[model samples]
Target: MKQVLGSCLCNRVTYACENNFSQFHLCHCTQCQKATGSAYAANLFTDVDNIKWLTGEALIMRFNVAGRSISNAFCGECGSAVPYKSLSGKALVVPAGSLDCEPNIQPQSQIFYTERAPWFDSVTVCKKFDSMPK
Candidate 1:
């Protein structure tokens, strides 16, 4: 599979990873929601060594949720989420939005479904728009 590139909104942090992902999940857990500031977090899991930092490696910052396993790494300049190793260091977690191209696989499942935001279901029935509704 061809390698894919990912970067932050400010283009300060960049990385490359192969399209070989083991799992993709949309997590509705509150922590994930809070971390992403969204209804859920779409994450792709791959081997720990799957990612290669291409630029601004030193500018990356990480926050480990103390007493919990959850952690997030992002660009210090733009605060855009990036790939990081899991607490166990068993796998690399990539924020789906950071990717330059779509993944080869679709989301395998919606994890923590019970924890989904209350308004999560409203979007399906809500008016669709390419941009803000006029």
Candidate 2:
């Protein structure tokens, strides 16, 4: 695998990671949902050593949710989630949306499925639109 580039929605923060992810998980945990403001969080997990910040390092802010190991990193300018090491310091968690290139692999698992939002299960059946509906 080669290095993949990533940036924030505002393009103020950029990073590169060696494509060495060991797992790709779509976390359906409530915390993940809240952090993403969506049904689930698509995260790619890898060793922290594989990540390298390319620019706007000082614009990144991180917070640890109370009473949970879950932590979130985002660009202060645009509030787009960015990669951060897990609270345990063992792995880096990259929000799949932040990647500028497709990951070398696909999501391997849906974790905490039972805790997923009620509407999440119906998403696949929802209407598809290339752009916002008129």
Candidate 3:
């Protein structure tokens, strides 16, 4: 199995995981939106044991929504999302943007579509740019 490296925005935390992912999901749940501070969250799932922390494990912080299965793990220094074990402890959920390279699988489905943010309608409908418009 191939391994892909991942790190936080400030590089405070780093890890490696198998490039083989079981599932990739674009989650539109309200809880996910709030946790990610975005319209949706793109996540990759793999076996719980597939990841190895390379450094800064102590700088990681986690938050679990009260009375919900939702959870998030991030770097304390830069607040960048990283990988975290599933609440059930069965899988590792990787924030797609954390990876140094690309995952082998594309997003398979959108979960909780009904809960998607109203302003998230058709991202393609907006102007496309290689960089931020001045």
Candidate 4:
């Protein structure tokens, strides 16, 4: 089976997951935007049992939105996103940005498109810089 490694920003937390992802979703919902502090969240969905924490498991923190299905997890030390089981208890949601390598699957769909931010629409048309502005 394929495997992928992931780490938090400070490298305080590390993990590995069997790349058995069934879906890749770019969520534009309001909750997802707030949790990621970005235009959208790239998440990979897989069975909850597929992940294994390599280190800093104690530093992982999870938050579930009250009365909502939205939830997220992060590394306590670096505030970097991490994988967590979905509220439904069926699948694990892995933050694509946290992965050290790309997964086999590409994004399957963009959800909550109607809730997307106005500025998000023009991002694709903006200049693409290879690196930091100089």
Candidate 5:
């Protein structure tokens, strides 16, 4: 199994993942854009059971963005985004930018394409979605 390491900006909260990843996606929904304050968010989906928190459980904080049922986790000290789990409690989504080592994965698709900001750069040829696909 491959292992990947990640930590918050303060180095307080750390985590590790095994088995590389099967899917990578970039989300551009308004909620994601507002939460990340960026053009889009790069996320890697992996089994929740495969992740292990290595440190600073006490410094981790969670926020539920308005109107979005999903909650986002981050470091309380340095405010660095951490991995987030789905409300269904089945999987984990780790931000590629937060990884301590390169994730060695590229987004396979872009989601909420229609909601993407007008000024956001257009890159990648992956499939695009107007919203979470039904």
Candidate 6:
């Protein structure tokens, strides 16, 4: 099994996960944009068991958004968003950009397309969903 390691800017918080990701997505929701301080968020979803925390468990913090518990585990010193676990308590969604190794994955879909900022370009390429695409 392949493994990938990642850490915050200060290196106080570290994490590792299975290199094989089950799903990848770019979220354009306002919550994601604010949380990441970016136009969009690139997330790689994998089983919770595949993720391992190497350091700084005490510094991790969490917040609930729209009833979903979004854990914003980060380095308290650097304030960098590290890894986040779902409130469902089933999976870990790591920011692809935070990985130390380049993950062989690309955004398969864009979610919350309707909520995307007006300045953002419409994702005409890959599948786009207005909401969660349920």
Candidate 2 per-residue lDDT over residues 1-134, each given as its tens digit: 79999999999999999887889999999999999999999999998888889899999999899998899999999999999989999999999999998898899999999999998878899999999999
lDDT of 5: 0.82
Off by over 4 Å in 2: none
Question: How do all the candidates rank in terms of lDDT, highest first?
Answer: 3, 1, 4, 2, 5, 6
Off by over 4 Å in 5: 122-134
lDDT of 3 by residue, 63-131 (tens): 998898999999999998999999999999999999999999999999999999998887869989899
Q: Which residue pairs in model 2 clash with each other?
A: none
Candidate 6 on 41-91: residue-level lDDT in tens?
888888877778898868877667766444555567887777777778788
Question: Model 4, 1-134: lDDT tens per residue?
Answer: 88899999999899999977899999999999999899999999999898999999999999999988999999999898999999999999999999999887999999999999889989989998899988
Model 1 per-residue lDDT tens digits across residues 1-134: 88999999999899999999999999998988888999999999999999899998999999888787889998999999999999999999999999999998999999999999999999899877899877
How far residue 1's Cα lies from its native spot in candidate 3, in Å, is 1.5
Between the candidate structures 1 and 4, which one is better when assessed by TM-score?
A: 4
**What are the Cα lDDT values of the candidates?**
0.94, 0.93, 0.95, 0.94, 0.82, 0.80
The predicted structure with the larger TM-score, 2 or 4, is: 4
* Ten contiguous residues minimizing lDDT sum, candidate 2: 45-54
**TM-score against truth, every candidate:** 0.96, 0.96, 0.97, 0.97, 0.83, 0.82
Give candidate 6's whole-model lDDT: 0.80
- CA lDDT of 59 in candidate 2? 98
Candidate 5 C-alpha lDDT tens digits along 15-133: 88884777898888887787788988888888877788899978888888766765678899998889878777888888888898777677799989899988776546557899998
Q: Candidate 1 deviates by what RMSD?
A: 0.9
Preferred candidate (lDDT higher): 1 or 3: 3
> Once superposed on the true structure, which residue ranges of model 6 sit more than 4 Å away at CA?
66-71, 122-134
lDDT winner: 3
